[model samples]
Target chain A: DAGVTQSPTHLIKTRGQQVTLRCSPKSGHDTVSWYQQALGQGPQFIFQYYEEEERQRGNFPDRFSGHQFPNYSSELNVNALLLGDSALYLCASSFGLAGVVYTDTQYFGPGTRLTVL
Target chain B: AQRVTQPEKLLSVFKGAPVELKCNYSYSGSPELFWYVQYSRQRLQLLLRHISRESIKGFTADLNKGETSFHLKKPFAQEEDSAMYYCALSPSGTYKYIFGTGTRLKVLA
Candidate 1:
């Protein structure tokens, strides 16, 4: 019954360095989405992965990439990070059903706090 | 462009008083709206969605397509209801959701 779980609850990285945050979707969930939440701001969608392929992406740049494993786990990787990248990275999972339905409800993880020093 | 807006950054109300959090959205096509709440030390979770047309924890929001607004309202505010509320909208052709800046609700006793 465990919900979405993320690894390395907190991470510290220097500017220009790369970092990878991991997430395991809730049990029985398939679709995984990544979001970035700056301090005092709501989350912004980065991208979404389904069946190991990115189905949709937000307005983020190519420096931000993600991979979804067959196990439904996901990893968010950011390259040449900037101070602006220092924010809480949230991972959400859902059934990826079409339109609005109970299955479309996205369950979110506690989130990984990334600090770019 | 799809966008969600929560005009109020902070809302304070005395406990037991009525509370309302306003939300407005801009979208060209059919959109699905949702209200997500994050309590202190808690994960961000879905409070309710327009499609469900259901209320949760005594909070209800009505989606007015004509006005492009979905405002969350509660009859009596409780300290436990204090949290960060985000308004999100999903466009008709995409699964991506756009969220507002969020409103922080504070209920004082």
Candidate 2:
């Protein structure tokens, strides 16, 4: 079975430009989450989407946003991207509340490397 | 603020040696801890979660509430075990994960 997949394996943009990244979850998964991983660091959660609504969010700024589709696919949008935005964006999928009582264990994708000039 | 910390940036050991990757967390509420590993040219995958109490790839992690630490351990390290290991935490009933600065393990031959 295919695991989580992300589009635009690599992208480049200038500061102040907006960018969007896409992700398709694994088969049978219902929830999708976005994270940013700087070089030599672990991922930092941006937000989580379930039932096409944002359930939770991390400490990211307003420039970061996301959307989940009825099909469980997701899009992460960043506005006014800065130089520090150059990092790997990872998308993770899980079965949501149906699979686990607390929180579902997440499976990640290969990630899209975003570079802001 | 809740956070996860992995003190070591890189750890190297001979094959067959015992391996331990230290992780510590700070959270106000009950948290679910997890270990995620990323091998070369691969996506990050779950190694073990504290709730499962199951060993994967001969590795195990026991969550210590008092110490607020969950350390990954293995009796015999294999060369294939070398990878970037991240310690993550899920705050009470939440899906957002707080990940620590990862440790890169190198099991030398």
A1-117 per-residue lDDT for model 1 (tens digits)? 789999989999999999999999999999999999999888999999988989889999999999999998999999999999999999999997644333388999999999999
> What DockQ number belongs to candidate 1?
0.63
Model 2 per-residue lDDT at B71: 98
- Cα lDDT of all candidates, in order? 0.94, 0.93
Question: Candidate 2: which pairs clash?
Answer: none
Per-residue CA lDDT of model 2 for A13-111, tens digit only, reads 999999999999999999999999999889999998989988889999999999999999999999999999999999999987753545777989999
Instruction: Write down the worst ten-residue block by lDDT for model 1 chain B.
Output: B89-98
Q: Recovered native contacts in candidate 2, as a fraction? A: 0.85
Candidate 1 falls in which docking quality class? medium
The TM-score of chain B in candidate 1 is 0.97
